[model samples]
Target chain A: MRGEAPRGAPNRLDLHDLSLFAGWDPGGRWRLFGEFELGEALVVREGRLRTDQREFDYERLYAEYDLRPDLKLRLGKFLTPVGRWNLIHADPLVWTTRRPLTTELPFAAHASGLSLLGEGAWHGGVFDYQLFVDDSLALDPDRGDRPLAGGAGMGLHDSFDHALGGRLHLLSADARDGLGASLAWFRRRGEAADRLLLGGDWHRRRGRLVLDSEAFYRFGRSADDWGGFLQAVARIHGGLHLVGRYEYIRSADLGAEGGAGLLGLTWRFHRAGVVKLGFQESAGPRVQPDGWILSYGLLY
Target chain B: MARGAYRSQVGLWSWPILAVLLMGISGGALAAAPGIAVVVHDPALAAGLDRASLARIYRRWQRIDTAGRPLVPVNLPADAPLRRAFTQALFRQSPEDMRGFWDERYFQGVSPPTVLASPEAVERFVRRTPGALGYLPDCRTPPDLVVALRLRWPRAAGIDPFGLCQEGD
Candidate 1:
């Protein structure tokens, strides 16, 4: 599948991926995968609100590769290997709103990277582990104007920054009748500022019930202090999801706590799409006294 | 004397009728299919798999085998009765729900298992593949395959609109 390229299309780049996955038995080693997606969004980053009116992003690229039964390595930009929600994307999640004040504040959600992932079992349960490294662009500096505990300015400092992180996950053999937990960490070293992050999530689902919670702590020595946040999500029915969160931040120069309470609903229109709506109330020294947000999201 | 006669006569007919009804019920119960076998590739696996373990393997949870081979699960064609039986006994979710489940995994960079055309194909594939696993009807013993678990349709029946497997037998 790799050799087909549209000729005379010099500006059109040809990209492909080959992945081979096998079970313990030889017969399960069939190769499968291919797809391409075009994504675009427009964002107006001004004042307190960041709105995307028109923009284009390559949300996914189709490719293939398969070698060695026991290991598989993917080469391309994939979703950032971070918390549960970020890894799974927006569609399959139970909650309507993106994780509140805490979950979205810390990490970049997607990156171009090489991912090495494997799964096996030990101690009578299933285990999945992954290690990945990526080259990423720094966050736009103008996006870092929030009042953090330790005054840290956010923006691009250099061009050649990179990040590395991994996750160790454990689940019971039964997907619906098991517990899943993971630990992840990442760091980016830019010419002017460096950033470090550590985070994890604990999740459980049984029958119609689901529970998931995650925490992240970020530190960098560039301009301000260290900050982190914790977010939790619970699903009672397939339709209604409840969320709660807390955030604590310590600047290199100052120490304070920033926190919020979030209650939300994520209604799945179908498995591929969903509608999310929520309310957030902040409670902390450095929080928006009357800050509330409304958002709509989609995944396809 | 009259009261005693009336009581005796009522008891005589009631016992005879009840006995006949009980016998008829027992006959019908005995005629039903015996316990169904959950077939796999390794005969020894029959000893290790419980309802929970078998459920996990079918759901693509425990993908690796005890011997370190990755476990690939094969399914019958979308309309097979045996496939319905296996999925009903295992996932409790409908085929549509199962597709949605796999879609989530796919977007997350996980691939779903390959689907085979028939039970014969599954048996042939599993026999050749070391870590491949699939289920078939318990009627015949195919060569080179194992029986992993036994499943009985629950007595308390409900139309599982979502095709989710009932929990814990």
Candidate 2:
């Protein structure tokens, strides 16, 4: 459940979602995994229930085949492996309630197609890669979450008609520190411009302190966009963290350019549950409006 | 001018104090416990395993061994003293600190190792199941069970192949 209250807006609460996941390993090289979500099940405005906002979302449905101990093949709908955050963006898994604009605002969050993933030890570090392609219409895409840019239909925050991309990361032996890069090329619906996205991310953990950052730029004809954020989480005590982030984003098409600063507290009360309280201040064009946000997430 | 000098002096002293505090919290308890032994099924395989491999197996970073057989690693309950010692020695992390890692793995369809109720139960399970691996206090490992790596007290010194310990620790 999540509750939000902007400085001047009414306090609102909603039952955010219930996610069901299933995985089967048939004792062979083949495996199956699927995720289904019932989202916005209930919404309350000031004090009344809002029925118009309820929705059911199909998040992911995929099958995997183990080509070898170090390599695997996956097919169907899955989260795009652009950066580390998006792969583990579940509310319980991430540090903040607000998603970084750089991770999701520039591209679709999910892709339906095929992917190849592999990992191996190199020197004293580990190397990992994921390459994927999406060439057709997405399956059951939730277009409502995507917002408009300029006056074009399905312009910003929309799925690609065709996309090809890959991400590569090199990490310390313990997987506690790493740096990665991503590159992708795609075309938008009803537009003739070709877009190329370049991204880089890095994270390091030492004792009770962790620092993470990412930057991305999408090159398109008359619609260039770029953004970046650096975040830090320092452990104050058991399960309690002091979180801070600074971010800036610019979109030529929407004529929006701004930055935001956030300070928050995250408490992992249990292994599969987390409660977050964040207060944000933004200048313009924010993904999540500037406000106080309190969210509780649990995995059953 | 005097106040600025005093503030700079305090800032200089804070780092060493904080460093010592962090060290004491992360490693002090493990220094009091006995050594931990990483064990597997085949005795010969013990000679080939290294500290890096053990850390990888437990973290679910490497699911299969060099022979392409799936590795099944087990653990004692989270609160077990021996489990804390092992986690601190291998990953330099507390059980509480690892919850986020396991949660991310859970989201990716990979689960943490199966946890047994006690060290005895872990020993019994590892003895019978092929490709099984587990950790226990050094003295509890019988001759039949193979010791892959012995993480002794004073973890900074690194892996102790001989499994040596003092009378009490």
Candidate 3:
């Protein structure tokens, strides 16, 4: 018999952050699991004080079953497994901080609903395909005053109304040696829209050289927008990594392209933990002063 | 004058004596190489694997067999010197680090490779199951079993050369 845990019990917690996670998996042919998260953080936006914000969130609660070797069924609230960076949790990430603007602008981390996942490998290539139906709720505190809308904006209320989307991933043969290319697509319901993302990464172990580049084309009913980002990281021995990234976003509604460049270094004391220091400067159309960022992450 | 002559003669004699003693020790150690075997149930598989491939299989990177069955890899006790040698040759990471890697994987719903306690246990399990692969000391190899890869510990050279398969003694 498979082991089981109680529903809604605290399975993990971090005192420094005052965060708690509770989850349970019931033993059955169809496995069921659920998780909850509660935490607090301080934010300063537009030089205004947004301090000590309390957040009560349902991280994930889902049931999954394997119908076949290549097909699986999932239902309930879960993280949208779209981008490579989004599928894995932040704590286990290679970088101390996440790719800002891009990941945040679309949606919050998880959606509640049903999904179908298919994964397989053949001829030295790997593929992951997913189809999902979700009722999403955005969690951005700053957007509280904005009126909700059914499509494209956070105005959609607790109406059983749903969204439909999917993603497809095709990886090249040389992924193990750290050189590969991938293409991904996502489309949400209620808006006549879609997004196509293409990305490639190359890495060499001898000198610790890495290059990552990605392009996104957003197609909507009114007008289309395009954006691209590139990042390079080099290990300078003694557990220090230097990184640089450039990003640009252009839309039909906007007069000119807006973008930012980041220069950073990360120190890794352990495989699952790191400390990072970086400077970000925004330019073109809407410019912001170069600011410094310090962050740390731990994974268990 | 006689004392000086004796001291010089003794110094010359000591150099040749030390060289001859060191050569004898190395030669004797080479003459008696310990017999360590790499054992598996399938003859074809035993012939197909090289050192690098075997290492990859143990590391969970190569999950499928030539015939497409999910390969099940097993190893001896954690502290066994042979196991250490095998992992050192295969993973280039310490066993403790490998354990940590697997623990994280477990949280992600992935299972690590199965571990067995002894060579005899590995041999018995491999003999009874298909898709099972393991290693054992050469002298205990069963006739029905095949020799997939062989490793020898070189006391003289201070390194263990792995995946060297040869016919008979």
lDDT of each: 0.52, 0.78, 0.54
Task: Tell me which residue pairs clash in candidate 2.
Answer: none
Residue A108 lDDT (model 2): 66
- Runs of candidate 3 with Cα error greater than 4 angstroms are A1-35, A41-52, A89-92, A135-161, A171-174, A177-207, A251-256, A284-290, B1-169
Question: What lDDT tens digits, residue by residue, belong to model 2 across residues B86-163?
Answer: 887776667776876788878888788999998778889999988889987776677888888898643543445234
In model 1, what is the error at residue A91, expressed in angstroms? 3.9
Off by over 4 Å in 2: A7-10, A136-158, A188-192, B1-37, B42-53, B65-68, B137-140, B146-169
Candidate 1 per-residue lDDT over residues A1-300, each given as its tens digit: 011112222211111212222222233333333233422222222222232323223443323233333345666555666666666654344453434333444555554556776665555556676677766544323212322212235332212246677777776533443333433344433234556667666776655555566665666565444344445556657655555655555433224456555565656666655555555555443322223333444444
Of 1 and 2, which scores higher on lDDT? 2
Tens digit of per-residue lDDT, candidate 1, span B1-169 = 9999999999998998999999989887655444346666666566667765666566554555555455667887756655665666565544654665676665655656678986668778888876667776555436556777767643322333122222212
Query: Comparing to the true complex, what docking class would candidate 2 get?
Result: incorrect
What TM-score would chain B of candidate 3 score versus the native chain B?
Answer: 0.66
DockQ, each predicted model: 0.13, 0.22, 0.06
**Model 1 misplacement above 4 A:** A1-53, A60-70, A92-94, A100-104, A136-160, A176-196, A206-209, A222-257, A283-300, B1-73, B76-101, B109-111, B114-133, B140-169
DockQ of prediction 3:
0.06
TM-score of candidate 3 against the unseen true structure: 0.58
- Model 1 scores a C-alpha lDDT of 0.52
TM-score of chain A of each: 0.62, 0.92, 0.68
The model with the greatest DockQ is: 2
